[model samples]
Target: MELGLEVAEGPAPYTVLAVKGEVDVYTAPRLREKLVELVSQGKHQIIVDLEGVDFLDSTGLGVLVGGLKRLRSNDGDLSLVCTQSRILKVFEITGLTKVFSIYDSVDGATAS
Candidate 1:
């Protein structure tokens, strides 16, 4: 599946990247590239809104973790706004739910 990204203004100088679509090995790299560029540009605080995502695999999880690591290294933060049960199950099973801050909604993620 293809990925769609939309940037919206969030709290302060944060940029909320609203991501929609399946995030697997193929598409995950695209996200990683964008996030890396953003981080390099000093845009550290980011919220990845996964509310529209329908599927996620191990590669996708890796992408999220990579982003978190990159942000943390830059003294920034990365959060998630995912409400999908199936996706949430993967995060829980992989213990990523604790690694990445998760919120019930995009608004909440942006707010926090």
Candidate 2:
């Protein structure tokens, strides 16, 4: 499936990035570029909504980690919005569940 990325301003200091589709090596670059673009544009607090993602690989995880690091270095943070068991499993298996704040919904992510 094709990757889709929709970015929007969150309640206050957050930017919500809604992503759907496969996020393997092939599509991970696009997501990384979007994260870089957002950061460059001064959007520090980012909530990556992965509820629609059907597949994710190591490359995608690396991208998220990189984005989180970048944001944190800027005194900001990166959160994730995801509820799919399959997708959440990747984080759990990789121990990234503890590294990234994973929320069930965009609203929940934005609240924190």
Candidate 3:
């Protein structure tokens, strides 16, 4: 499956990255590059909306961790909008649920 990425403005102090499709090894690089580009543009507080994502592998998780680290290094943060059980399980099993500020909706993440 392919990975679709869209960049948009979020609530104050945040930028939203709407993601669709699968995020596997082949497509992970695209997501990583976009995150890097956003951080380079000083968009450090990011909200990755994974509502449209159907699948996510370890490589995808790594990309997110990398992005989070990058943002934190810049005194910013990376949050996630993901409610799917399968995807949430990935974060949970990886112990990343505690690391990332994940919410059910964009509004939820923005409020935090």
The full ranking of all candidates by TM-score, starting with the best, is 2, 3, 1
TM-score for candidate 3, residues paired by index:
0.98
lDDT of 1 by residue, 1-112 (tens): 7899887878776788888998888899988888888898888999998888988889988888999999999899999988889989999999988799899986787666
Q: Cα lDDT for residue 6, model 3?
A: 94
lDDT of 2 at 66: 98
User: Which residue segments of model 2 deviate by more than 4 Å?
Assistant: none
Q: For residues 1-112, write the lDDT of model 2, one tens digit per residue.
A: 7999999998988899999999999999999999999999999999999988999999999999999999999999999998999999999999999999999898988777
Could you estimate the TM-score for every candidate?
0.93, 0.98, 0.98
**Candidate 2: which pairs clash?**
none
Worst 10 residues of 2 by lDDT: 103-112
Candidate 2, lDDT over the whole model: 0.95
Q: Across residues 6-39, which tens digit of lDDT does each residue of candidate 3 receive? A: 9989877889999999999999999999999999
Two-way TM-score contest, 1 vs 2, winner: 2
Using TM-score as the measure, name the better of candidate 1 and candidate 3: 3
